[model samples]
Target chain A: MPEIILIDDPADPRVAAYRDVRERDLVGREGLFVAEGEVVLNVLARSTLCEPASLMIARKRVAGLADLIARLPEDVPVYSASQEAMDAVVGFHIHRGILALGRRRAPASAADMLAGLGEGALVLALSGIANHDNMGGLFRNAAAFGVDAVLLDTDCCDPLYRKAIRVSVGAVLVTPFATAQGDLLEVLTAAGFETVALSPGGATRLVDLKRPSKAAVLLGAEGPGLAASVLARATTVAIPMATGFDSLNVATTGGIVLHHLAFAALRD
Target chain B: MPEIILIDDPADPRVAAYRDVRERDLVGREGLFVAEGEVVLNVLARSTLCEPASLMIARKRVAGLADLIARLPEDVPVYSASQEAMDAVVGFHIHRGILALGRRRAPASAADMLAGLGEGALVLALSGIANHDNMGGLFRNAAAFGVDAVLLDTDCCDPLYRKAIRVSVGAVLVTPFATAQGDLLEVLTAAGFETVALSPGGATRLVDLKRPSKAAVLLGAEGPGLAASVLARATTVAIPMATGFDSLNVATTGGIVLHHLAFAALRD
Candidate 1:
């Protein structure tokens, strides 16, 4: 069982990491990120890839989370504080009354993650998905569709940000993702994966494409879609849309394409 | 041409409807709602179902929006204010430099909207979707996939809410939508539509369902899914998901299911 520490002071050195979370998020959280709410905390406890550094809970909610608290590693400290004190420490009203600080393991290289997947793997590759909400939604969709892994280009936002984690409903904690800097298409191609780039201008419609044994769908950010050079290298497919309508949000687009791949695999 | 009026004072009674928007959103906007940003303003201008009462724009952005401004009805007033003045009036920075007060037409009944769609119509029916962002996203997805119309149970949030309109990229302005107090499924069934209710414990996996000539997908808000009674009245369909995973966001689910129906219709 984890040690239960009592916290009375908002400025306690032990809980210093939890201070002004939103401002810290903007500057970067170094190697650590905060996960909020009971649902996310439960997910954090279950994740094998992420290590929880500590946990903070409202005093009133401790009894409800006893089982979850007991599951933490012996060395991990669990702290309980009055809701007022906890709110002051976090610099926000954490209405859900639970939070955990988690550290990510060293990220796998995109090449390494792709190499580990089986021959029939389904992957989601994203480019320039700078919006944190979109990034979180993509991770949530990837997990729902049973995507093997997600690959992000250098420009993609950090999925571990608190808002992203909350938006994902903790899916980012479970979904394995990696970032690569250059020539993501070349890396994907070299892995023997059939790459399909989603674009408004495409050679084929999404529904018409034959399901491949190993497939990766490439998605770009919302407004400025995939670069022309990137589309040139892959089999370009468009989600058939109403004439003169704006394209679907990038996360929604990813969900549809991933759904197609997932159910297509089930049929095979 | 819209009469361009220069307003120097922030507290001008002419623009009284535009004050403290966030606070006003909580109480209500009477029959009026604000549409912000260039894209949404253009969409609001083109909407035949909604009428714009007035427009408030940053003076600097006037020249760029000349074509859009000219398209507005002659009776509609266009008020241009300096940036600082506009900010003081709206109680927030109007960074997009465009705002329009639009009034919804007296809503059509669910039965009425359903009666108007053709025999091969595709519709989205929603229940208890109170979140503004989800409401907006549903509209955006509906428009992207060419859904003929949207039907909402009385429990759903207002799609005309400012945040919903913004998140939808203005899709809500153009898509025809209606709300009914009870038994929305019955209305669809009476209209000769096959209604499919989305739930995690659905009887049919989404990909396996054959396309119907006229289909309406019923989606519930996340967390508490469709009520058992509601699902009992329609064909319950589940998105085949990975085991132990929560379901997709309601909007994303709508996107995938609608994508299926849209593509299926094309093939037929």
Candidate 2:
């Protein structure tokens, strides 16, 4: 079990990493990201791709989180602070009462990650998804649909962004993901993935598409969807929508498409 | 065209309805809701169910929005303020530069709203969904899927809440919605709608369910899902997910279910 260290001073140097969290989130967190709330901390505890550097918990919550703390490694420090001091340190009132600083393990190349998937694996490929909320939602859906891995184009925002991690409910901690700096479709094709790029004006309806043994659903930002070049190279598909409205929130679209692909795999 | 009334003072009584916009959003808009950004204002302009009471715009954005202003009723006030005055009045940094106070039309009872639907209709029924973002997302999906109406139980939050409206891309303004005070199933059944309640423990997989000519897809909050009483009264269905991972964002679940029902209707 990790040792419980009481912190009365918000400015204590030992807890320096936990200061000005929201500001640091906007600026980069260097190699670390803050995971908030108990549910997310639980995911971080079991995550293999990342390690918890330390934990900062409201003193009142430590008693309730005994089992959760017991699960973490012994060397990791668990800092307990009064609600006032905790609020002072984080520069905000965090009612969730649990926060963990997590560090990513060594990065994996997109090609290497895709090569590791099984023959019939499902994947999600994201391009130009700059919105943190959408990025997080995609990861959450990808985990639920059992996607083997997620590949992102260079233009996509970091899934490890604080809001994305919080929005994803910590799915970013468990789901395997890698950035593909080169042409996403070419790399995907090389890994035996039949890419289905989602678009509003695609020729084929999503329900009518034939399921591939190894598939990747490629999604882009909502308004300017998949790039024309990428769409031409992949199998372009559209989700049937109401006559007057053609757009669905990009993340919602991801959920729908992943559901179709995941269930198709189940039936087969 | 609605006349542009320029106001340099943040305290002008003519634009009193737009004051402390954030606080007013939380403490109820009396009978009005605030719509932000150009995209949502355009939706409000076209909506028949809700009419704009007044508009507050940054002085810089007026020239570009002439076409949009032309669409509003002649009597509706268009108040333009300098960026500083607008920010001071709204109690926030107004980056989107457009805001409108919209008043709901004569309220319709849930039964009456459902009664207005044609023989072949698709509906969404929500219960215990209090999150504004989820509420907005569900409405956005409902609009995208051409849902005839949305039925919310007493436990659901107001869809017209400012955050909900913004998150929905102004879909809440255009989508028809009514709140049910009593049992939701009986109301749906009375309206000649077959209710399909989605839950993690549902007996039937969503993909296998036969499409109903008139259907209402029922959803609950993410954690508890549909209540047992409601679940037993309706045709319960579950989305297939990876083993040990049954949760999907409530709005995402709505999207998948609605997509399935909408596409099935198209195929028929």
Candidate 3:
């Protein structure tokens, strides 16, 4: 068990990494991935692939978390502060007083991910998914349905963005992903992945979705979604959207298609 | 068309509704609700339930929009600006020169919605689903499938919040949503709605979804999700998440579940 350090002062430089957490709303030098709440922190600390740089817990809430904090690496700092100071450092009220920050691992390259996954599996290929929270949600959906991996094209938000890390509930850390080169279509083509571009207005219906030898689903940002070229880059498929209604979001669409694939795979 | 009041000046009070578009981000005020692009504005124009107080478009974009804009009574202002001034009013650059500002409609009541829905139809009831975008996505999914209507609890973020309305492609305006008075369990139960609470850890698997007499699904906010009391209020059904994943967002979960209900109803 690592000994917890008591620092009631908000000015302690040791806790500086957690300072003004709301400042994360604006862009910053990206490296450290910030995680919120005990659930995400516990997931990070426990994952063999993730190691926390430090942990912060308000003294009042420390009793329930002693067991989890005890397991941190001996040198990892566990700073204890009054709830007030913790709140000040984070720049807003945090009901869950405990938070953990971890170092960002270099993401695998697209070629490496393709090599690792081998031949046939359904995976997510993201384009222009600029919102960090939406990016996280997309990853969360990908992981929830066991997509082989995610291939992020250029212009997508960094998966390690702090809000993304928090929003994913650490699922981004678990879901294997890579920064793919070139447009989504070209990458999938070179990798021998069948690109399936999802569209609302396209002629194909979702009920007609068929399993491919190696499938990669391409989704664009919400509203002004996948650029026409981005759409042009794939063997397009349309979800069976009801008439007089709009379509599912990119993230939700991923989940539905992934679930559909999973079901078909089981029957096969 | 209400004589195209073209103003070159950004300060023209006629376009006051379009001024300071981003101010809503800094503070919540009753004055903010924006609909963007032609598709959304068309829904607004056709909706007798909600009126667009005004419409804004570039002189060229207005060519095909004449009959749509003409439907508004003459006094209801249809403001236009040179493309440059319109950009100035919106803060960030927007190519969707056609915009409209409408008086926020009075929120509809929940009791009426429960009574109004068909006995065997689907309804999506949202609990504390605060993210404006998630609400938008949920509406998109609801409309995409054949869900009867969206019923929001008291604690929800406003569906008509500018971002939600736009993200939903203005489906939020057309979808017959009504805010309920009591807790979801009480209002929905009193109206003979069978509540299906969605949880990742839920024991009852979705593959076994039954044809219900009348159905409403209660989805919680992302992360901390449905309160225990709320979960207790419904017959719990689990979306079979893949190995090692937590769950999907409120909207995606709603979409998948609605898909099942739609299938069940269609088969029946």
- Top candidate on DockQ is 2
lDDT, candidate 1, residue A107? 70
Worst 10 residues of 1 chain A by lDDT: A259-268
Indicate whether candidate 2 or candidate 3 has the larger DockQ. 2
Question: Compared with the true structure, what per-residue lDDT tens digits does model 3 show for residues A1-268?
Answer: 7778998888988888888776864656356777788878877876655578888888888888888887888988888888999988888887888877787556668887776665567779988899887888888888788788888888898887777877776788777787776876787778888887877765555555677868888888877877777676567777776787656667778777777666554213
**Docking category of candidate 2:** high
> Could you give the C-alpha RMSD of every candidate to the true structure, in order shown?
1.6, 1.7, 4.9
lDDT over C-alpha atoms for residue A128 of model 1: 93
Expressed as tens digits, the lDDT of each residue in A193-242 for candidate 1 is 88989999889888777777889899998788999999998999998898
Worst 10 residues of 1 chain B by lDDT: B259-268
- A79-142 in candidate 2: lDDT tens per residue? 9999999999999998988999999888688989999987678999999999999999999999
Instruction: Sort by lDDT, best first.
Output: 2, 1, 3
Model 2 over residues B1-268: C-alpha lDDT tens digits? 8899998998888888888987887787799999999998998988989999999999999999999998888999999999999998889999989999999899789989999987778889999999999999999999999988899999999999999998888889988899999998999999899889998888899888777888889999988777788888888999878865556899999999998887764325
Every candidate's lDDT = 0.89, 0.90, 0.78
Error of 3 at A84 (Å): 6.6
- lDDT per residue (tens digit) for residues B1-268 in model 3: 4777887888888786677777864475465467888888988887755778778787678778888877777777777678888888777676867888875566557787678877677888998888898898888888888777788888899887888988787878777888876788888888888888887766587757775778888898877877887777578888777776756777888877887677653324
What is the C-alpha DockQ of each candidate?
0.85, 0.87, 0.57
Error of 2 at B138 (Å): 0.4
